[model samples]
Target: MAGRPTIYDVAERAGVSKSLVSLVLNRSPSVSEASRLAVEEAIAALGYRPSRAAANLAARSTRLVGVLIDDYTNLWFVDLVRGLRTTLGEHGYRVTVADMATAPPTENPVEGFLSMRVEGVVVAMDVPAALSDPAAPPVVIAGTRRAAPPDADSVTNDDAVGARLAAEHLLSLGHRRLGHLTASGGAAVVRRASFVEAVERSGATVVTIEHDGPTDEQAGFDGAIALLETHPETTAIFAANDLMALGALGAARQLRRRVPEDLSIMGYDNTPLARTRLVDLTTIDDNSFAVGIEAGRLLLDRMNDADARTGAGAGATSDGHARATHRTLEPDLILRGTTGPAPAAAP
Candidate 1:
């Protein structure tokens, strides 16, 4: 009676079996609504907490997945994780995330997951050369343009198409002198190429396409300032990502340029920042959530394939040599307060 509440105590108090309580705790959809509610109420009243360490030991498998991301402050990854959990949780898998931005320069971040014996790994950041041949768990790359690993799958939005959409929208809004704020990366290259092509096709002048240091607000702000200083005729600016677009907003305010009056700003990724009242940036929706879902689905497929091959006496190393898959989801333009008809004359 003097011990911490356990699942047994919760089951007895709720008048339910331990297995039923476990199912409810696991969030299995098969459990009846009434039974689920009863178990939840009992656990809440008794303050019973499940022992993850004990459960992992008993199951003989961690049922854990690792997600490697570049920056946690970037809200695009937040949606990607939400989508991954939506699908992964249904299969009794839990995700543990690591920020590569904070890792030691010489260490391979994925090693942390491998040491924990994760069932799979999802890479939302650029894949490093050190992790090119991760042998065991299935791998999936999300929201990246890099080619998949030998046996991995990649899911991303079409950056080129999204960029073209942005360009065309700006052109339609009477933007004749346009600028692009970008950073160095494969995705950035594609977006810049498409944006340039669209501007040329529209018979408009591309005033500037600045390659900022990093894809962040500071880079965006610096690039925007540079564009404004060098090419004051630029009426619109399209940033490679949402964070960069926010930087453009700062530059506009600092330069005494009214948004959608003196300059129209466009950002990509349609992150939460773009939708906020303070930073209503018009941008391309990369559909990162869908990309995450696709990555999770592909990883599940690869895992299932491995299980099948193992059951048929195939070796664990065999799947890594299998053919890889590349899936691209479509992106769309989202209109907001940041972008509007170009100014009649540049101020």
Candidate 2:
């Protein structure tokens, strides 16, 4: 009946305690159906929309999850976010994504999110030294392989296994001489090391690995050019990621090396670019969506445990924080048109 309706208005009209109204709004199972219905009816009658901040205060939690991504241009994060939302939404949690690329060089994304009092944080990028020692709040590392805080949980694809798969595919396709275009990221390091190991185990000639500054399409392009020049005999190439793989494709075209016909190219991440008709890159699917889902589940569990400990009148939190947990999902090898039998001449 006034300019705006608040929780007090909804509770008054519902003939229930404000705390009861809060429980119903939060979808607490303990709230009786009668009370829930009464709250709902009152909400409709008063046109009362609960503010997010208010709801958070009532729940004694922000219920906000921060997701920090390395770069937005990389399509792998699209599926990751989809999975994150699927799990987080069911539990009434909202996710706010921030790109590390856009953040101030002196300020890390995790600090900024913590300053806002987010309930949990998921670092989807490589672990920065600034976040190497998060003391409070749940922190989960997603899709990355860097040294994280002692208490941090991690959900990531086994990059070494994925690289081994790529190397196996290329070697099985009769590719004796290969090159790997990589960069300075942790994932790239693992992929490169594993790819080389797989190649060496095959008893084939050593593979040529080239690196660039950042992991991007341009880095891939430049690295490919350098690799091709230094190892002109390379019959196949594997990029650290799909973006670099696309660059390798460009290099092939410029060098007049027809894909699969003159050279085979493979990439990691199996991003949307790998599925495109023009690219059709043979790649290792890191199962980004699954990583996101696992990260969400792990973070939720951590938060719940922390809350339970706090409510139990424990003198100190559990030592669970001292022991880090890491989960690795297996990646799939997706074969596409970009890879085939090595050229007859073998470059």
Candidate 3:
């Protein structure tokens, strides 16, 4: 078997000392441009891949970030993770993701992240208070600002504004009696509240159905059935998330209600599914990718500062409670085929 090439091999090929090769590979700014180029040339020629583990050891940085998500089936979560991966990859950091399927009850996710010795963590779910430990590494919440721990930083969409946008769209279409399907938890609750507020502000009435289940197709469908049964006068429905919105569409079909003609529907997240010709759901674009990017940048900054503090023996401090830093990304209203002016008022 052939032995793996090491820094020594690169040094020999580039006619430089092993220390010089190490310095160049580590991106030491002190190395001359010529030396850096020569080392790179040799590395490319040898088809060598630098050992990230070894590099991390030498630099005292794991360069690993942990991401905890509530569910993986949702396309919105998938897109957010993709955004985080892209941004973190650009900064030379890898992500370790954990999906706590259907709302984790314990702190195992936090424990798992801590066990990995990740430089930082991005909690993409509404983690319980018990799950948040001050002793753990820096943590940031993504998606909903409502679940942000007192001591944790967060990035969220302007859900209130987004909800209002959806409400306004429906109202503009002459929707009067409205129904909202909401997921359980802080984010969903806030969005539902905003929707109700918008309806009231616009001189309309809103009937809300809270679903305490995963924000998936099934939950949406079930919620829709109940909502329609209870509020037969509802002319439009707004789902807290896109997945549920799709479910609601399915429920409407089962009840023989034609979309836009019999009812108008709006969903949030504006996921890929919403764009499909079959669904064509009018939704609120949360700009999830931008949220992921911002979260990644925040995590990196926290890691770098923590690294610097530990190196200087200054001890790292938590930013979770240093003045509620909430970042609300703007959301846009996407009009699609699912929503239209309310059908001519029944005779």
Candidate 4:
């Protein structure tokens, strides 16, 4: 019927056995680099698209989806996962999650998921090098990443917009000098940069203490302490996340600065901690749950498209998924007890 080019044809063309091709597709470390390059070249030449059924060497669907997150301790992902299950559960698909923080230092998270035979993958963290493989599954990235695959769908919040909104909120409170609590990498870089721009654009002064490590509560505490110590005139503080905001709160208490009186504090990601009666932090709602819902929807759309193309050759492309599309949701500021009018004077 001249339906599609199968792995057998690639094996014949590459002058290797079908099992060797499978090993190459799986990115087994046992294969020599030379053989890997040869197999990749053969696949490219023949436009052989590898799917879950093809990679597993079976034609049946797995109905399992892989999810990789940056950190497990950060409860922000809870809403994201719930939103994903809300849509995925109805379709009979289940998710298996892997946390990058807990993964072995030498292991590649993407390789593990591919080996697990997950039909698709959703990444809420950095894009892995292994994801560029031609045999990789359809993928959707669920949050703001600095770089995403050219073929991966992205459903994320606009951190830059949210950061600017924070600037506006603090500026309206008559804060002439401000501080940003941030980390050296991840989405914080973008948020901090945009925040500084917005604050400076409003003719206000902004200083920041950026941590060289993860943006956890410790980083937030340390950063806030440093920022305040150096820039006492800074009347307001904006943290990259709620945990950091909590840390900032601790810094305020330690330094004897009163919240919304001596220092106005704000945070990002309206997580559960932000909603707590004790925390009651003014924060940005990036809508992590909504992002998850859209991510699930995009992944299902990709899967449907991939399934529809089962009988067709991918025409010389390494990636099997369709062209990537990005969806960004607006960010909203949620006012709470932590942030108020800038101090009558910086304490």
- lDDT-sorted candidate list, best first: 4, 2, 1, 3
Residue 176 shift from truth in candidate 2, angstroms: 0.3
| lDDT at residue 276 of model 2 (Cα atoms) | 91
Worst 10 residues of 4 by lDDT: 308-317
For candidate 3, the 10 contiguous residues with the lowest summed lDDT are 311-320
Among these predicted structures, which one has the highest lDDT? 4
After superposition, the stretches of candidate 4 with alpha carbons farther than 4 Å from their true spots are 1-60, 314-322
| Cα lDDT, all candidates | 0.80, 0.80, 0.79, 0.82
Off by over 4 Å in 1: 1-59, 104-107, 134-136, 315-321
TM-score of 1: 0.79
- Residue lDDT tens for model 2, 265-329: 88999898789999998999999999989999888777655553333223324546468789999
- TM for every model, in the order presented, reads 0.79, 0.81, 0.79, 0.80
Scored against the true structure, residue 67 in model 3 reaches a CA lDDT of: 85
Residue-level lDDT tens digits of model 1 in 282-326: 999999899888888887666544433332232323534368888
- lDDT string for model 3 (72-189, tens) is 7777876677888888887677898888775457747777777777778888777755446656777778877444677576788888899989999999999999999987766788
Tens digits of per-residue lDDT, candidate 4, 1-347, equal 15556766777788875556665665445567888888888889888877654444434566788888878877788888888887777666788888888888998788888888887888887777777676788889887775677768998899999999999999999999999989855578889999999999999999888888887899999999999888888889999988899999999999999998889999998998899999999999989999989899888767655553442235533454456889999989999999888767624
> Each model's RMSD to truth, in Å?
10.3, 8.4, 9.1, 10.1
Q: CA lDDT of 320 in candidate 3?
A: 29
